[model samples]
Target: MVRRMTMELAVDVARAAVQSCRDAGYQASAVVVDRVGIVQAVMRDTLANRFTLQAAEDKANAVILSGVDSSEFRLNRQDIRPEINQIEGVLMMDGGVAIRAAGSIIGAVGVSGAPGGDKDEICARAGVDEVQDRLDFAD
Candidate 1:
């Protein structure tokens, strides 16, 4: 049985990610996706660029497809990064963090619209940290 994170959790993560980015003085957006790369929730901060939403989703897809953080995948797989990015919905960029529970990656959180991918990744991690307690006890 494939145990996926709930939509409620997905929404919470997305909200926290966007808020974290806002607190960091960046108008950003966040997208959460299930393990299979299906979007579970999305949230965008006001004044954020319209394309940020798609960017966030693509980062999350990168994580889901790689079973690792998007940034890590990109860093470790630069040889194939360009080719991978050619695929639809695959963005080998930063700002994607794996959402793990029950000893496995249950989903991922992606953030974008910050000045840099590193900044986006920091906000994405903050979102996952916001739900650390729940993830630790997840089934």
Candidate 2:
């Protein structure tokens, strides 16, 4: 069977991201998307802004759509087609990261509500690291 993100794993990823953000002294939101870019889970800290969830989802969607971390997109957004920017569910930000399993893009994790985009990205990366073992064995 093709490797795919499970609902349980999605929640684990989301929760881990939120916890990471909290540990980093921020109330944040996190979202996880499947390989197809479908949202699988979302979590928001009580103090996080309402928009944070949407932002997280957009970041994750962008990673899946572009096959690159959102930070890279943000850095090169000027060179990207304006039409690409118009696509719904795309956000050029630093908090989204692609989740790979056995060299295949299996999903992504995104975080928002940190003091800075880099902080948000750090939390998202923590989430990915939380499940590194699972990803490694998926090949």
Candidate 3:
């Protein structure tokens, strides 16, 4: 059976992600989604770009659906799997990460509005790591 992260947990993760991005001096939008690609939480920094929300959501969906970081999709362009991108809200680009705990994906996090994709990914990973302890405890 797939164990899902609670809504409260999702909020905590999203908050942590947003905080990390702010600390890094980048205004960003953070999105959290469950394993099945359903949105859980979306938080945007006060100074984030207006488009960050959608971009973050798309990245999160992409990771949740594809079971990998969105950047991986960009890196392996020739191996692109079109079917994964066909998902309604998926964005097959960058700044997203699949949350894996105990060898299973529990959710995904996406960050956007950074100066570069790499920066966005760093913020996203920070958020994921913030919640890593919780995931480990659950295991």
lDDT of each: 0.94, 0.90, 0.84
Q: Answer with 1 or 3, whichever has the higher lDDT.
A: 1
RMSD of each candidate? 0.8, 1.4, 2.0
| Candidate 3 residue-wise lDDT at 10 | 83
- Give the TM-score comparing model 1 with the true structure, all chains together: 0.97
Better of 2 and 3 by lDDT: 2
Residue 47 alpha-carbon offset, candidate 2, angstroms: 0.8
Model 3, position 57, has a per-residue lDDT of: 90
Candidate 3 structure quality by residue, lDDT tens digits, 12-106: 77888888889888899999999887889989999998799988999988787667798996677536557656766777777998787777889
- Candidate 1, pairs of clashing residues: none
Q: Give the TM-score of candidate 3.
A: 0.89
lDDT of 1 at 42: 91
Q: TM-scores, in order shown?
A: 0.97, 0.93, 0.89
The runs of at least 3 residues in candidate 1 whose Cα sits more than 4 Å from the true structure, single-residue gaps closed, are: none
lDDT of 3 at 63: 80
Give residue 7's error in model 3 in angstroms. Answer: 1.4
Best by lDDT: 1
Q: How should the candidates be ordered by lDDT, best one leading?
A: 1, 2, 3
Model 2 Cα lDDT, one tens digit per residue, 1-139 = 5989989888999999999999878999999999998989999999999999998998898899889889887787667746666888887878999999888888999899999889999999999999999888875
